[model samples]
Target: MVERVDEQDRVLAVVGRDEAVRRGWLHRIAVTVCRDREGRILVQRRSEHLARFPGHYEVASGGAVAVGESYEEAASRELAEELGVQAPVRFVVKFLNRNGLSPHWLAVHEAVLPGDPNPDPDKMMWHGWLSESELLRSMEENLFTPDSRDTLSHYFAAAERPSGQP
Candidate 1:
């Protein structure tokens, strides 16, 4: 089940994924940018059978926060489900995607999962590790989901900033 929320992120109701996406309802998603010990980023080619952005590239491994799950919990769950590994995830930031397409509240996180990720082929067609620069270059190529692109930008900017600053 999916949790549908309002502008303030308060749970308004519970619904199925199809209806939520079909109606563009506000929902919560936990996104994780898993970097290896060598600082390479994990990227994936989404399965062509998915409802949205099928066969496209994704900058991170993540998914919707279930009807009753925290952002961090969803992050860990998604990483394991999609990548088959567990790592301590740190919350980065939360932002709303209020666009016409696939609107959802994105909870961004980053982690250093220091091992090979075993991606589930049914969910992802391929997976690889790319340098941070290569991941940034991916934005220019328009190869990622809109939310992925936005979250990556936010994550990068946040990473470069010094502490005590917004």
Candidate 2:
């Protein structure tokens, strides 16, 4: 089950993930951007068997936030589940992504991987690391998941703002 949320992001109910998707209800998704010591971001191609954005490149590893789970918890879980890494993730930003394939309140987080990733074959087919500039250049090919693309832009904007400025 997923936690359904209202516009202000308060919990409305805990409903089936399918039901929330079918009804176009707002929910929570937590994605984590894993960076190496040199500041290279991990990039992954979703497995083709996946239902949404199959075979598309994504900047983060994440999924629907489970009922009763906090975004930080979900982000950490996803980072471990998808990339086989256990790392502490810090929340970076949260906002409503009403235009994505699965509209939801997205919580973006960042983590520094302790070691190289061992991606799950069922979730990711290919994974690599790229600098921010390289990722931006690759996005020009238009092969990335739409939501990840949007998240990248938001992440960049957030990083540009002064500390404590929100």
- For candidate 1, write residues 107-155 as lDDT tens digits: 9999898798889989899888999888778767757876777888789
The true-versus-predicted C-alpha distance at residue 16 of model 2, in Å, is 0.7
Summed over model 1, clashes come to 0
Per-model C-alpha lDDT, please?
A: 0.86, 0.90
Q: Roughly what TM-score does model 1 have, to 2 decimal places?
A: 0.91
> CA lDDT of 80 in candidate 1?
90
Highest-scoring model, lDDT: 2
Which 10-residue span in candidate 1 carries the lowest summed lDDT? 93-102
Question: Which stretches of model 2 miss by more than 4 angstroms?
Answer: none
Separately for all candidates shown, the number of backbone clashes (residues 3 or more apart, or on different chains) is: 0, 0
